[model samples]
Target: MPVHFSLDEYRTRVARTVKAMAAADLDGLLIFAPESQYWLCGYDTFGFAMFQCLVLSGDGDLHLLTRAPDLRQAQQTSTLSDAQIQIWRDLEGVRPADQLQDLLAELGLTGKRLGIETKTPGLTAYNGDMVRDALKTERLVEASDLIAGLRRVKSPAELDCIRRAAALSDDALDAALAATRAGVSEGDILADMQGAVFRGGGDYAGNEFIIGSGEAALLCRYQSGRRVLDPQDQLTLEWSGAWRRYHAAMMRTLVIGKANDIQRRMHDAAVEALEACEAAIKPGAPMGDVFDAHARVFDAHGLTHARLNACGYGMGIAYNPIWVEFPMFYEGNPMIMEPGNAFFLHMILMDSENGLAMCWGHSTILSPTGVERLSKHTLDLVEL
Candidate 1:
């Protein structure tokens, strides 16, 4: 098996998950989240875009029900034996959920109270409905947060992967900074950045690197077109370095030439907010308090109108479409920060009134002593 963690580590994870399932009063769990599956047994695959499920019984038995294509995928990447992996045929009237039901019957889990992960990209509504229809006789409850909560705190091995990813993130940023200048195309900067990560033995990021210039610099998400940098232009970038499916993300808004007064003020505010957030993110602190600190700093600087509602979120063991994880920093979130918790906190300021954007962000791991900023880059404004 190409499992990254030791057999003992995988066993411990399975034990903890089984304990959580017991606490939830579930007889078994239908884990649909690819991240959850990967965390549990190193079952890595994008095949989750289709119908695939990992059934974890109360006694800690794992059985993966997937399509034919992922049979070898699981065999090569996961710790599962060939017999433990059940192939669900794609016949005209057949549904994977029905195969899951049969597998459950063989495992004697039919009609038992089951927990289903319904809030992931791996489980679309169409498939969810089919699952409900197939397992109608069984008592199913939503249990997405069980694994999510457990995965929030990184293990030592997981942190090592994230630390390497963080270094790659810094390297990518340095490459992008060196490649960025007047007359340069966004494509060239992107190529340099991604190439830096790949050259460092990093994996593809969970999502496309967000790159925009000029007016589009205000965008926080990736969009379709690309453009060259003007002599005096603004560029915003949001990217992550992934290793072993774990991500460490960073965000920045760079000025091609000299930064205007408004942009300078916004950058200062972003830096201040980011620092304040860093100070607030510690063991025993509620995640909401961190966001509150960010809000107060930005509002104090008269940049409340330009600030993002949420400051950041946990990042690790991610898949396509996004790298954001649980314990999101927002108002009234009571999730407490604990040691080994890794998160990416981005302070973004998009001033539509002035048609400018400024941002500062990096990943950090919370330790018992204090917050450990992953990126080695300074917060100074990058003026190319």
Candidate 2:
């Protein structure tokens, strides 16, 4: 099999997952999250946008139900035997969902307590309703976070992928800095960044590179508007570098010209917040402590109203819409920082009074000794 990790690694992951399954009282788990599948069984595929499910039983049994296009995909990239792979038929009477229910029945899992990832994109509303109605099982429970929590603690191999992606993130940022200038369109800069990402040996990011210039910089969402850069406006960029589906993110704001006093102050506070966050990333620190660090800086600067509620989140093994994993940095979150955990801590501050924004942050990995910054790029408020 062309699995990303060795078969031994895959077995280890399955063992850990089975332990979690036992703890949750899940006799069977119907995994719809693509990342969870890859982590558990090395089932790599972008085909999750369609329909597929990796069934993991507490007894260490594994099975996959997918369509024709992903049948070979699962065969080549996963460690499933031919007998364990079930191809769902989308026939008139036997829909794929019906086939899924049949497969569960064949395995005698229909009557057992089962866990499913209800929030993943791979689990659509139609398929969800279909599966529920087909099985008529009240034992189905929502268990998205159960596996996500396990995946948050990166393995050595996983960290290597993220480290490479982090280097690519620096390259993309450098390309963005090189391509950004007065009169250049945001789309043009974004295109340059994408090219840099691919040319630097990075895969497609989980989400579109968020870019905006002028007052639109306050909006962190991605848009296709062809807004041209101005001499005095600032450009905000929020993006990640993904390698083998693992991600490392960076957020920065670049001014096309000289920065004003308000802009500089905001930038300084954001930078301070980022540094404080890094210092607070040791093992045993609560996730909220990092956000507390971020809040301290903004509140001290009297910009509490201008700051975001969430500073950042874990980033690894993700797909479209976002690269963020669970255990985000927010107020009162008791999720503790542990070794092998990787997260991005961004300080996004928007000064509505001045119609300017200053976003500066980077991702880091918690080590046995201390926290290591994943991105090598300098965290400076660049004036292009």
Maximum-lDDT candidate: 1
Candidate 2 stretches with Cα past 4 Å from truth are none
Cα RMSD to the true fold for all candidates:
0.8, 1.5
CA lDDT, every model vs. true structure? 0.93, 0.87
Residue-wise C-alpha lDDT for candidate 2, range 31-146, written one tens digit per residue: 99988988887888888887788888878899999888888888888888888888876666666767788788888887899998988888889888887887786389999998
* Residue-level error in angstroms, candidate 1, position 167: 0.6
Q: What local lDDT does model 1 show for residue 217? A: 95
lDDT of 2: 0.87
Best by TM-score: 1
- Per-model TM values vs. the true structure: 0.99, 0.96
lDDT of 1 by residue, 1-384 (tens): 478999899999999999999998999999999999999999999999999999999999999999999999999898999989999888887888888889999999989999999989999999999999999889999999999989988899999999999999999999998999999999999999999999999999989999999999999999987799999999999999999989999999999999988888898899999999999997887999999999999999998899988999998999987889976899989998999999999999999999999988999999888989999999999899
Q: Cα lDDT for residue 305, model 1?
A: 92
After superposition, the stretches of candidate 1 with alpha carbons farther than 4 Å from their true spots are: none
- Clashes per candidate (backbone, < 3 Å): 0, 0
